[model samples]
Target: MPPAHSTRPAIAFAVAAFGIGTFSLMDAAMKDLALAIGAYNAVLWRNGLGSLLTGVLFLGTRQRIPMLAVLKLHLWRSFIVALMAVSFFWSLTVLPLAEAIGLSFIAPVIALYLAAVLLGETIGREAIIASIAGLGGVAIILVGKFSGDYSDESLWGAAAVLFSAVVFAYNLILARQQAQQAGPIEIAFFQNLFTAAILALAAPWFFSMDATGEIPMIAAAAGLAIISLLLLSWAYARAEAQVLIPVEYTAFVWAALCGWAFFDEPVTLTTMAGTALIVGGSLVAARAKPKLVEHTEITTA
Candidate 1:
């Protein structure tokens, strides 16, 4: 086997782009599921089915069950992911897919600051400028929404996406930590398991068996999500985060096309303008190098 660093950046970027495309499709399917049944039920079924699929893969691979400490960390991440997924999917149910995706571009910028604060990484001038640009983009989008014939539902949807973006930023930081300790399969499996377990508590009130025909769609969403997560995890483990960050912006393009083709939601000028700024800022931030820290190693017997 080749060294981890031997993985070409081009290959990693390609994988990341493919992952984004799959995830964009998954999001579109999820939006459909949410509209057909309801956001809560959609989330419940998706996670439950995802857990089953990943669980089978986990066992087939003969991976050991995580210890209690690892399980606790997984549980914590699962909770955050659950909140992020629910909020983002709810926003999808109301907002245009491209608009919702454009707003989510704030997450990479937020992750820059989170890494600096939580991981002691140094922020550079480019990152500061990126943050300003990203925030400005968001302001522009919000102003456009307010000036338009926007309803309260749109405002709520925007708020939900923004909230999910914040949580997702933190989740990125946690992902780095988790990646150091476990493989992508383990992370994906436990994530679904824990999310399903948590969401199951609310299933009694919100769950409905009304949309059985949508099972295929829900399963497709879960399958795409799993593939995307695995691909991204593999890419990140092999390459620098900075190198892969720009690939994330490609989701906007995919989302825009998917929204137009599937929902007849035209990409508005506001979305284009805001997305350009956000993507530009993210690229700048990605170019900034984090300060390197030297580590002293100790051997444990």
Candidate 2:
């Protein structure tokens, strides 16, 4: 029989899956906008709009921003998140949709291992085997592309995607800790404010001449990104690592569909193979039960 606390993480995984799906759609919209306005410009506008929305919500809900201590964490978190967004979007422009999505799937596995390292959680036999199997699957899927015209440029893009995954894993660990202490709304508000500030500083360096036609799409993307981040943060705060990590893979299905519908990216056997391994690993991890520990504690960073 499953433990009583297991259900909460299961519920959180479900929510995270939905949020990832929504984010895929949002990425599709942003991709189109980026094509018109450039990736940097799109990011700038989206972050700015998202920050404004967060500001309004904070004011309306009567939530107060914390002292400099909390503000410092928010700033660092925002910088990393912004870097993540830029890198991921830049990769979107180069790699084939399926390849990009496949590589992005590496993050959850990274997070699973990191949980063991940073949070002192155990990586059981099942998870280790699952991780190796998942890596094998990814290698098999990319076997053909090894000799193709995949120049150093594409290689860098792949590296960027991997690096982004690492930062994202770190970001999640921090955000999850923060969420445990504060309400989701408080976390969301500070994240937006911090992201906005960082992007605003970056705007002059990255801004372009195409903002006029791209504002609407940027606005749409901002809304989706904000909502997705909030949902994911809230869900992670309530959930355990083993369960929630697997569900994040649902982003690929969403990415594949969105890539096909918007970017005309085709599905192939490799994608199916990689996706299968990912799902299998997730299922194995989800089913395993780790010994219960003290409840997670959250504090203002």
Candidate 3:
């Protein structure tokens, strides 16, 4: 039987999978709503309502909202998150949602490398091999796009998604560090607050009230947004890089399904091949034995 603490990482992995799937589905739903309404409006409403809900919930819970010192980190992280959202949403407009989402899984690869370089954890041979395989998978997918079904902007879209992935990996590191010093609520609360502030400036020019004549759609987006964030926060606070990274790739599964079902974009052989490599490589990384000891001594008298 595996040690008890071993289960903790496994539990975190489950939570991260939920986070990935829920967020992907939520994003797809938001994109559909945005198309009916408008992108800027969807973004504005989601951010505004999400920030409001977060603030209200935080106040109810009485978490010590991080002071200015921590707020600086919050702002920096929020900036990254804002950029990521813009890039991701824009990419979804140009690229097949599944392909764009597949590329975004590169964030986990970035996170693994960052964990080694920035956090000073040793990069194991398996991780290096997995990274190479994952990159090869991405190349295969991109090469297939040369058949001309995709647009010239698809390349830029892919690049944007990849950049977002990189920035978001750094965000994960910052969130993990903050989680150690404070509760997930504090980190989440300030994240939404600062993200709201950054996004609010953009709203004046971009915001709109036209959303398919559906207030319910806006409310649905808000609910999913909150669910996504809560799951992400809960998972990030608990999981190790290896476990979390693998699970994050599952987001593409949600995207692929959503895209196919809603947009009628047929899944191709190339997608499957690339997805196999990416998922396989991520699994290899996740399956690597965690070096940290899993069991602690009990104070037996």
TM-scores for all candidates: the values are 0.84, 0.86, 0.83
- Leading candidate by lDDT: 1
**Model 3, poorest ten-residue lDDT window?**
292-301
- Candidates 2 and 3 compared by TM-score, better number: 2
| Alpha-carbon lDDT of model 2 | 0.71
Error of 2 at 202 (Å): 2.9
RMSD of 1: 4.0
lDDT by residue for model 1 over 218-299, one digit each (tens)? Answer: 8999999999888877766554454455466667767988998999987777767866886787567555554322211111
Worst ten in a row by lDDT for model 1:
292-301
For TM-score, candidate 1 versus 2, the one ahead is 2
Worst 10 residues of 2 by lDDT: 292-301
Q: Name the TM-score of candidate 1.
A: 0.84
lDDT of 3 by residue, 48-91 (tens): 67778777887898655455666677788888878887777777
Highest TM-score: give the candidate number: 2
After best superposition, candidate 2 residue 255: deviation in angstroms?
1.2
Once superposed on the true structure, which residue ranges of model 3 sit more than 4 Å away at CA? 1-7, 149-152, 212-214, 291-301
What is the lDDT for 158 in model 3?
75
Which residue pairs of candidate 3 clash?
Answer: none
Q: Residue 231 lDDT in model 1?
A: 84
